[model samples]
Structures are given as structure tokens and as C-alpha cells.
Target: MQKYLILLAGCPCTGKTYLVNQLQQQFKDSFVITPDEAKILYAESIGFNCKAEKEALEHKVWQFYYGVLQLYMDAGKRVIISEYPFSDKQKRQLSEFAEQYHYQVITIRLVADFDVIWQRRYQRDRSPERHLCHIMQHYHYGDTLENRNLADDLITKDQFYQVCQMRQYDQFVLGNLIQVDVTDFTKVDYSRLLNELKQIVKL
Candidate 1:
């Protein structure tokens, strides 16, 4: 049987970790890999700030986690990887890996309002060694109104909306992807979301 790989891609403070924790609780047999855990493990090895250094460390971290994911998959286990799949390059790499392993990849993008995230970041207590402002400024993973224009020529408004929607929907009809807006989970019908996920995978 092929292993199931659910990749949770989202911005910080968007409840990715919360959802991951819930999933782990519900599915005790599944393996969960989170970037925050990786950062905590290798913080001393990789200095803070220094975009280049951070990028290198992130690459190493992802590679390590991906290897671990492959191990679980090889054992026919379900795995959940929670990370910010920001760039197109990273997504392509994941797609390639899935193709190579013949594993089913389900990507979930969690999103929230910028102001909400900003406030969340501000309220979050960080170690004295790390500055919250610096971290927030440096983390560039989401599609915002400012950068949306960068790719205006390549995609239509509707297509772009679909791309934004991909954050939630995962896969599109054209096999491109869908975006799910979880702005207010309290107002959203979570049962419908669960049903949608069930339809996609046997989980």
C-alpha cells in the first residue's frame, strides 16, 4: 500500500501547528514533522538573521525532514509535514519527490489576515536571543497584495484567486491547486472541510 503524505503549508500564526497537533492526536499512528521543532533542534548550529545562512539551514532542515518522511513512507505509514511551502521552487521539489516515491501528496495551505498575524506575532513571546520583529520581517512565505502584482502578467485575476485558494483546496480541477480561506474557522463549517478531505484521500 502506498503511504499518505499530508503537507501543511501556511503562514505563521495561521493555526498550522494547532491543526497538526489535532491531527496527531486524532491519528496517533501518523508521523508529524514540524519546522519549529527543527529550528529548536539546530538553532545553535545555525546563527539567527543572515538570510543566506538561514536559507542554507532551512534547506538542510527540509532535506533532513524529507528523508525522515521517506523512511515513514517506506514503512507504509502516514506522515504529516508542517512547514511553510513558500516558493514555487519548494513546491516543485515536493511534487518531484512525490512522483519519484509514488506517494500521494496532499497540501493544505492555512491563511489568515495580515493584521491578525501581525498582532499574533507581536503577542507571541520569543526568547531574548531572538527578535520578533526581525523574524516577522524576514519570513516571506505568503502571497500578499503587494507582491501579487509581481506575477500579474502570467496569471489572470481568476487564476490568481485560484492560486490564493490553493492554500486551502490543495488541488485544482486543472491539477493546478485550490486555496482554502480559513480566515474565521468559527464561522466556517469544519464538517464540510473534513468531508472534502475525506473525498480526496481514504483517510
Candidate 2:
């Protein structure tokens, strides 16, 4: 059976997670992987004190992340991986994996207006449901609020502007390129997007 490798690239708060969730619902057997969820699981496994151990924790988390990806690929499972900002090196790595595994690849890039992203980020940071690792990445270990300290900004507005303007997450095009403008989530036609992807790779 031919498997597929779906890669999603986007900046913060651009709705990559939302699209992944929808895809998972459509393709129930496909494996979905994200770094944030991986970090959370690893932190929880070690009793959740990761502030002082950021570098060590990150190393372990990525090791586990790629390890799991390899496992699914070896098993010939359809995989969907999401990245905040897919680097050039990572794109090359995925291309190699697709070649080795004989899997069709589809890379989707999601984008949004900076103001829309900022507003979404503001709300998400304030929400109690925000993950602990994300909080620890920017603020102190015990800090629950992401916007409490301006000096400890997660990624400054200027930095985010540069990334977006420079089209950093705009080039993971190893296979078919699907660019999605997610400034308005409600306006997104997920069914159409899914159907388009289905035409490219067997769901």
C-alpha cells in the first residue's frame, strides 16, 4: 500500500492545529504529530519541572519526535506532521524520508495577517488551557499567564513581523504546494481542501 506524508508549516496562531484536527477526523488512520504535544508528554513523564532543563528537555523531545515519525513511516502509516516554522534543513530531511519510504508528499503552508495572528495569540496566551511547556519556554516555571511580563515575550512582534514578511514558513514545497490563507478560520473551506489533498494522495 502506498502511504502519504503530509507536512504543515505555519507561524504561531495561523490555524495549523485546526487544519490538522480536521484532517485527522477525515483520515482516521493517519498519524498526527506535533512538537508541542510531544513536549507536554515528555514533561509530564518526568514530573513537569522543565524550566532549568530547557535545552535537555528540547533535545529529548525532538529525539522522541523524530523517533515516532520513523516508527510510523516504517509501518507504512499515513503521517501528518506540523511545524511552527519549518526550517530548510527539516524540509530536506522530510524530502529524504519520503524518498526512502516511497510515500507521496504534500506540504501545506498556512498564513494569516499579523494583526489577526497577534489577536489570536493574545487570547490563547491568556487562556488557562494553554500548555505548561509553552509558558515555561517564555516565562518562569510557575508563571501561568503568557502576557504577564512584557520583557519575557515569547516571540516579539517585530520578530514575528520579520518572519512573516520574509516568508519563512512559506517554503516546505517538497511535493505539491497548498497555500492556505487562514486569516478567517470560519471562511476556510476545509472540505474543499481535504478533497484537493485526496486527489493528490490516497486518504
Candidate 3:
């Protein structure tokens, strides 16, 4: 099995974590690198509660994210799994990194029905994480919702980031399978995904 970076590109709340968990268990050698999770763990270890509103904390978390990513990528060889909403630019950067390290890229992009995703969010516990409504606005807010904010005198970082995420999701679709509905996501269904990947990746 050749070393590869499995990019879990999808909209938020599309079960990337669930997919990563299963992948890690199936392939023990795989290094699942989740930037957000890593940042959270680092914060907890340091007795800090990193909030998005805090620019300094956000920067620190990103520092850790990039630092950890470079650290893992520097390691000899392993399957690196990441659930990032990768834009075209980021994908290009990833390609360059893979070329530099002689590692292949096997992206396992996942997607879902919008309504289904919204329902799942309602079933989950309340938290500071993304809300279904926010995600919906982010994904589909290209001309309609974005125009309202873009017309404003000043564009907030939050608005800019939301637009970036939407573009990234669009780029992912152009590269990966067309909207594979994961509305009724299950381990059995995930098994099919794995099997197909095993064929392509030959890992």
C-alpha cells in the first residue's frame, strides 16, 4: 500500500469525523490528522478554552494546526487523513506537498443531502460548534445571501471565511464524485465506500 493523504472534503456536518474514525480503526497505520480536533485537544491540555471570537486564540489554534500538520507530514511515511474544506488553491498546495514527498493523494470526499444534514443537527446536542442554519447559509449563500453582506461597507472575517468555504465546497465537487447522497449514512454504506477506495488506492 503506497502512502497517501486521504482528504475528507465535504460540507460541515457531513459525518467526516465518523468516516475518519472508521478509517483509522480499519487502517491502524493511517494517521488521521484533524486540525480542529487537534487544536481543541491542545487547548484542553493547556487548560485553555479557545474561542473563535478571540483572534489570538484562533491564531494559536491555527499555529498548532499547521505545526502538527507539518510535523506529521515530515515523518517518514503514513496515510494522512484530513477533513478540510479544501479550496482549489489549497488542493494545489496539497498536490505540491505530495510531489515533494513522493506521496499520492487519494481523496475520499463525502457529501450529503442538505435537508438530511439539517435534521441530524437537530438530533445532536447543543454546542458552540456550527449550526445547521449557519451551514446552510454558508453553502448556498453564493449570490443571494452573500450579496446582502458583500454590499455592506465592510466585510467581516466571518463573512469572508464563509464565502471561502462555499468556494472550497464547489471546488471539491468539481474534483470528486457528484453529490453522493449520504443522507442515510451507515457503517454498511461506509463499507462500500471503503471497498471502492481500496480498489482505487490499492491499499
Candidate 4:
């Protein structure tokens, strides 16, 4: 049987990295790919931070990651991709790619309270060359409670949350896709989550 692919998606500071690391400790054979790591590699190689140059470099970085993912899947290895797969477009593309390789793809979406996320983002440290701090600050400003009421009307927060919560393993068993919410992790029962995943993947 081909190895499975676990794709973790979430906003910045949502603990996707932590979860991936934990899972890797448990599953020694799994391969992991993280976009931030790719970005750092690309930045180091190409001297990132210049406006036009950084944009071009980032594009190349993602292209490289996509090719790397395909290479791993072709080798029949279990790969765990950690990134913010935020849109239907990305999900559809990844799903089609996995299907082409006959590899089962399991998507896990991590969610936390906005306040918790914002606080984490605020405390995160970034390299001097990376503008992530500024970017995150901007995101926090827009998503803050003071601005959320105004922003909430412009978007379907609950629907989006539900989508993230329900899109993981549940979607896969339906012969489609899978989404799980890691919100309330402190109270979450990991054993139940593991059992549900095993059933979905028939492990």
C-alpha cells in the first residue's frame, strides 16, 4: 500500500508546527515539509528582502516545494506538509495531485481562539531580514476584537471556522476530503481523534 499524506493547514501561530513535530516523533518514517523552512532556505540562497526580488524568490520557493512533494509521493513515502492551505483552489490542486499518485491525503486544520492566536503572533520573534513580524502585526491589527465586528460582517467567520473544523478526515471518508479542528486542544481527546483517523484511513 502507498503511504498516506497528512497535510496540516492553519493560520500563523496556530500550532501546526508543534503538532507536526509531535506526530513525527510518533511516526518515525514520516517525511515533513514546511513552507517556512523552504522560505528560509530560499531567502538564504537568494538574499531575500528586496521587494521585487523577494516576491520572485518566494514564488520559486513554493514551486520547489511542490516538486519536492511530488518526488516524495512518487517514491512512495509518507509525507506531512505543514502550511496554510487557505483556499479551495489550493485544496483542490493538492487533492488532485494526491489522487494522481494514488496516495491518500489527510488534511488537518488547526484552529485556536483569535485572541490566543493574536497573542502568540505578537510574541513570536522573527529574523531581522524577514518581514514576518510586520506582516503578522498587520494581520493582528485587522483581526483584532475591536476590528472584528466590522470585519465579521464582511466575511462568514463561523462558516469558515466550520469549514476548517470539518474539512479534514471527515471529507476523506466521504471519498472526498478531510478537515479537523484542533481548537480547544487542552480538552481535546487525542485518543478519539486517533481512532477516528484510523477508521477513516482504515489503518
| Residue-wise C-alpha lDDT for candidate 3, range 90-142, written one tens digit per residue | 66656767776667677666666655655554444233343222222122112
lDDT (tens digit, per residue) of candidate 4 on 1-203: 74577776665566767777766765677788866677666654555334556567668877887888778878878644445544453566577778888877776666566556655554443223323412331222122233232322222345444654564322332132444455566776656655666565543
Q: Rank the candidates by TM-score, best first.
A: 2, 4, 3, 1
Highest lDDT: give the candidate number: 2
Question: In angstroms, what RMSD does candidate 3 have relative to the true structure?
Answer: 9.1
Q: lDDT of each model, Cα atoms only? A: 0.54, 0.72, 0.57, 0.57
On TM-score, the leading prediction is: 2
Give per-residue CA lDDT, model 1, range 10-77, as digits (tens).
55555666667766665567777765566545544444445565666767777776677666656666
Candidate 1 clashing pairs, residues 3+ apart or interchain: 109-167, 165-178, 165-179, 166-178, 166-179, 167-179, 168-180, 172-177
Query: Can you tell me which runs of candidate 1 are displaced by over 4 Å?
Result: 44-56, 125-178
Per-residue lDDT for 86-189 in model 2, tens only? 75757766777788888887788888887999888777765667765565543333445545443233566677678766766655566878888899999998
- lDDT score, residue 202, model 1? 63
Off by over 4 Å in 3: 45-53, 122-165, 173-179, 186-188
Clashes of 2: 0
Candidate 2 residue runs with Cα over 4 Å from true position: 47-52, 79-83, 137-153, 163-167
Candidate 1 lDDT trough over 10 residues, lowest sum? 169-178
